[model samples]
Target: MPEKIDYLKKIRELTQEYFQISLDDIPIPETELVNIEPDRADGLLVGSKEALNYQYLVQGDITPFLNKAPEGYFLIGFWGHGFNSYGFYYSRVEPNSRIFFRLPYGGAYMNNKREAIRIKNFLINFFEFKNKLKTATTFNVVESMGEGFHEIKYKDQTVKFKGSVYRQRNPEKHFQKILKSLKVPTKRHQHIIKLPSWAGKKYEDMTPKEQEEYQEHLRRKFTWEPGDLKKVGHEPLTEDEKKLVESIKKQEEDVNKE
Candidate 1:
């Protein structure tokens, strides 16, 4: 309970710093909580590795907080790890809205359309996974192996699976297969998939920084250069990449018309 509170406090402080906020202006009141366990309701999770602790919280929908938040304060939440280390992510909501994600002590993606879509998908799947956890007959966590797994018992059968902690490749399809075998309802969490409003904005309206970020996402998504076929071998793109190329073309057309 105290851990969660401390993390939230740190997260708020980091957010203030990121936004260059003056604490005196906001006047944060003392927050009272009847049950700290409810903090996990928003996709928060706790994990331990050796002597360090990890706290993960996903703020899927930040609209409710916007009215009370200080101007230019667009923070959603954070992924806190260890006692002294924490990383925060932010999202924008107005025109040219975007979400920025930072990897732990690594690279970050800014105002990226693909990342926004990825986060949206993750939040949807994650909340549904949390919902599915409630029906399990028994749930246990294991960490002896390299990457730990969960042993979940639903009805007459037991299955072992790993949680999706912002991984690029996940066993969600496999998990869905298990849930299907258990006759689980898949459409119970439509409301939980709320992303920032106006996720895709006009290219001309985007700030210079956001335009760079958008182009970076495209570069990352479509790795092949114009003459890559001659210089280096390239594998055929997946269906998703084809769609992305088409969308990029459409965006260019939209920009030309403007």
Candidate 2:
């Protein structure tokens, strides 16, 4: 197990080195560090909340931390149980030598999967830019949802396909076709809207004009929903599903009333 004292010391050392400020300079009150257990892998770090807020200010907004980070820098956060936290680390040298700094109450208000996906996507894009300034960088997304784990990788050219889980080792051939269809000058947004699995069959059966209309319909509806179009594409919500959504919305309102 990691020692609380050791982790706190390391955090202080890292913050001083990266931000050029001692732990005392941070805005979070010292008393907040009391419950942090360094030895535990999952426990929060002392002063992490303050450090994260400071980083956002220094970096000129969360974009740098959210998108492609420069080489020698990375952001880490914890998410689960109705909150998301933020923090950043940077390397002074390679191989086990780095600095870690955190922000205060970083996880306080955020609590949802959509928010998590948006944050993660932004960070991945940022990292992609940083990696590309050198040689081409390989982009990978890994998901570990308790029961299963999956990973997908894409080359620099394919970064346009933003949220896709399909790994394309050679995405060049289909690049132009995808670009023309999506009507976007940048490839980075490809993963943003995924066609349903049944889209192929449905698209094939329809006339060219029908396909165009269908594609346009989807372009206007820009929300994220899992499963291919065959299951839950651009079709209107079912009456039952709509009622469930309404019910949940009312429940939310009732909770807010209290």
Candidate 3:
């Protein structure tokens, strides 16, 4: 609780330094950001590794919040791990006309409630200035793991905004990472299917019903059993697996020959 407050204070200080607005000038009162535990209603597994927290500050109305937020924000209430940080949205009305900004994860570690208030004050000023800016400027310092800092310039001033950075993790190269973190078996690799060149020829020659039957057979044989693929130390390949691999090789060979 104290940590949350400290975070608010820091945000307020940053806002004041950048935007020249104090906590009192901001119309909305600071409220505690609450941690909502993931539940079945949220579509999260009972013991999933991810967690979510949300905070809202309303000023004038509720209509803007609902209509203006991006699709991700709407989906936010549904999943836990998709987003892993704390942030706030400001509204001019009871529940509408709001803009949201996601804060870095560590921002939640403020000392006390009063400090959190200060941070909120800082954010409001920063955002207000951000909205008024005309050009963006890069910051000399780097903050989070994948985040970059930038300053946006307005006619009379500039405000800083944090940028998110994402890195692609390869599942094949980091199989251990995926396997170690798995709560349940992974889904089968339907994306990459190996079919023999002869199989394609046969399919083209088959009747529609025969094609349907062939497709069903493939699905039944190749589709993985739930939770089977996620296990570590799984064997190299079974007889069926070998057949699939051979078909894939034949297809590749045909393409190469062409």
Judged by TM-score, which candidate is best?
1
* TM-score of each predicted structure versus truth: 0.30, 0.21, 0.21
Residue 151 error, candidate 1, Å: 2.0
Taking the tens digit of each residue's C-alpha lDDT, what string does model 3 give over 1-258?
Answer: 454334335545654553355646654423322233443223211110111332221222123333443322221111212344332223221221223333232224523344335334445444444333213232121222233343333233434445432112221332233222332234466787787433644555777776656655554554343333321344565554455545645665689799
lDDT of 2: 0.37
lDDT scores of the candidates, listed in order: 0.42, 0.37, 0.36
Please report the candidate that would top lDDT against the real structure: 1
Sorted by TM-score (best first), the order is 1, 2, 3
> Candidate 2 residues 114-229, lDDT tens each?
33343333334433333332332332332122111111123324433332221232323333344344343443645568775435454456777765565555445433343322
In candidate 3, position 26 carries an lDDT of 57
> What residue runs in model 3 are displaced by over 4 Å at the alpha carbon?
1-100, 104-110, 134-148, 151-258
- Clash counts per candidate, in order, are 0, 26, 33
